[model samples]
Target: MSRLEPLTMPVPQSASPATPAARFHNVEIILPRQESQAAAQMICEVFRAANDLFPGAPYRTHVRDLATQMRSAPDGWKPRTAIFLGGISTRWTLNSGEKASLQRICRQTPRCLFAGSAIFLLPETGLNTRYETAVHANFAAAAKEEDLPCAPAGTLTTVSDRISTAISSFAALRLLTTYLREDRGAFIADAVCDYLGLALGPTADHSRVSLQLRQAAGGDALIVKILELMQRNIEEPLLIRDIASQAGVSPRKLERRFQEKTRTSPLAAYRKLRIEKARQLLLHTSLPLTEIVAATGFGSRSNLTEWFKREYKTSPQAFRKQYYAEREPQRSLA
Candidate 1:
């Protein structure tokens, strides 16, 4: 499995020039609740700092940003993202101007997104503000399909309001310093790619993207069988036609509907699946190169190396090295 890399630290509220890609995808600041006066003040401070940094950039041009119930927004906060999911049991209110809170909601069912899926839910955004997170990463090189508009991740309602104090504020400061010194772009790109590949699938392309099916029990059953077959005989040099026959679909139709939906051809997608698995084993296990090749369904080590390089721009050995060296440092801390 690929790992998620967080930004080393939050950026200082100072002015600095960075690419759009580098500017975004480097930080994931999860503000679970911002309803209190303290929350409002904290949000204001963040905005003031951002305004001081980039005086001209607009904020909150998108509607999703203004979805907050608050009447006023922070000085420089840009509400520039829209999120689309299968469905969200929205928190609604009544006509009496009293807040309406609902009970008995299904919580925490992890949503599964395939590779190359893309959705744009903000076709109608009325607010006008720019949005940016103060973090370091190369958001540009991280492919576009992976950079869909992000939605609020956690449940809107929480039961408790107990714990106080900023969580790990001191530790955050130290990490931020180190991150700025490092090649934050590469790490950020990795994080961004992981997010994209996760939502779309391992080989999703931007030109082709689709919405994820929310509750596809039957589709999921088919996915399991297909994935099992791919995993069991990855090195068989099988064609899409062969796989489709096994999957109960005609080659041409699969090419049309499935490939269009996924933005990647069946063979390419399967190769990605195999390579990703190969990548995992190569990094996690002490298995030899030949064994890894056999395990991932490559005909030979050379074959694996060639394909891995073509897709990832690095040899298997090099990929293993980078992944481990980059990953382990982050992992041991967690």
Candidate 2:
């Protein structure tokens, strides 16, 4: 069995608590490949921070083929990632829990002979928020058939081949990150190659260069770092000072930079980001309102509803209904 421990500490409100030298803490999860209930238990434990897995017996054998993997990233406060990998025959169903513990989507892979999977969870709110959108669109574009299964509430969605390949490609990331920090352009390129099997072309080349230059420019780098930190730990109720500390700056300095760049305080920006995340869950997932609140870092359900009303001029439930109603015709045509 694997152990899941929280590395995050409660962040205080005082700005002095943030120091210039503070770095984001890294939490490690290592799970060895197994076939029995222990494997299921281990997998659940590994993702307990965000989700719960209810593997049917027929699906148990599929776990036999999965290799143990490790992920060491800063804690994501609400949206925990859940992964479902099936072997040649897929029979697993995963339910994103009833509570708001998990926010981000999970990965489920197809029934590949070796490995297949796809991710299910919420979208990214900060940093490279469009990252999930780009990857999802690309994968969908290449998918000839939807092998992925979507079960009723409390069941697992089957993984698609494209999604599975994308997920499996990252199985070697423990090796890749050893030499390249995540901030480097090469790191992103390697990941794209591993996941998409596409070589870096001129467009990618230019994008990488632009990103590098931007990171090397000025306050943008600090902003990027802070965004990364927020993206990682958005589930936690972190104070501005605590976030600033992770970016290696003072609270006041980080706030000043945010105001200059976005015309909003850092806290306001982060809260807005959180609201957007909740909106994603509301629109894309059937998660309960309570879970959405928990996953989005809203202190309570009422707070989430209030925030939604403020941002969209409607309640979350009504918003979800309207979105689905508008999309029903498109879904039917498709």
Candidate 3:
């Protein structure tokens, strides 16, 4: 009878393959974001940390922010300092290892930081919202949940971007304020809302089910349609509002559904979609950074450079130099 008690315990192998699982992990690290002068050492420390845990782990991208305006950040850039996840295991795939190291920095997860801190969940776009740039260290880890519509990046960086001075949103404005930062949760919540608005653009939710049952209980179709549209037009530089319109819903409705389903908004999704495309472009092309910026709808070289600096923490030129270009020298030496 005592032995029988153990039999009821579900073996690890018995777990359903489809169940969203939590990756139980704890991480603590300080990313010095504005310390680009020490970026090389930081890079080494990050790799060492990763190797310490998962040996022979296939590494991805080393995203860096190369902003020179460390003392006074650009209009939307300051205080937004933070790090790319320095050491974390990406969901392992067959080919990821083969492409590991500096040569393919374009397609890997960027190891990013800025202004002596790491920014979490910063959009790769040129604009920075009233989100708290950073005051403390950021923490993030992967927790798998029921499948949600994802960008072609096929990934999400669920993280906490530290708030130095928080602000609230009245409707539309990316500027910062002190009121929001006082209440951390509310600030984060507001940031999420703003990003969602960006994602939803002007779409509406046509969720007939929720309306039929609980007046606001329907969202599956809206979510599904939005995902499909995003996937189909992965290459286009469309706005979140555009995605909402395609779903036959208003931006507000679509944003609501996105919030309900994925706990994030459509604008974040759109930004990520474009960032993922840029990632692919970085991996596959020898195109100049300016050309890449234009191709990815990043507006101008300076803007794209700023975004790249904030999102990945390195200038595109440095990234290409370390990963893609320098390899030839190594080969020649060998």
lDDT of 2: 0.42
Candidate 3 accuracy as lDDT: 0.38
Cα lDDT, all candidates:
0.37, 0.42, 0.38
lDDT for each residue of candidate 1 in 283-311, tens digit (9 for 90 to 100)? 77989899988887788889999999997
lDDT (C-alpha) at residue 295 in model 2: 89
Decide which is better by lDDT, 1 or 3. 3
Ranking by TM-score: 1, 2, 3
**Model 1: number of backbone collisions:** 24
- Prediction-by-prediction clash tally: 24, 26, 42
Off by over 4 Å in 1: 1-232, 235-238, 326-334
Candidate 3 lDDT by residue in tens digits, 38-148: 333433333233222222211222223222112222233211122232222222111222223211222221222222112322332223343333222112222113122
Worst 10 residues of 1 by lDDT: 101-110
Instruction: Give the C-alpha miss distance for residue 163 in model 2, angstroms.
Output: 34
Tell how far residue 302 is off in model 1, in angstroms. 0.9
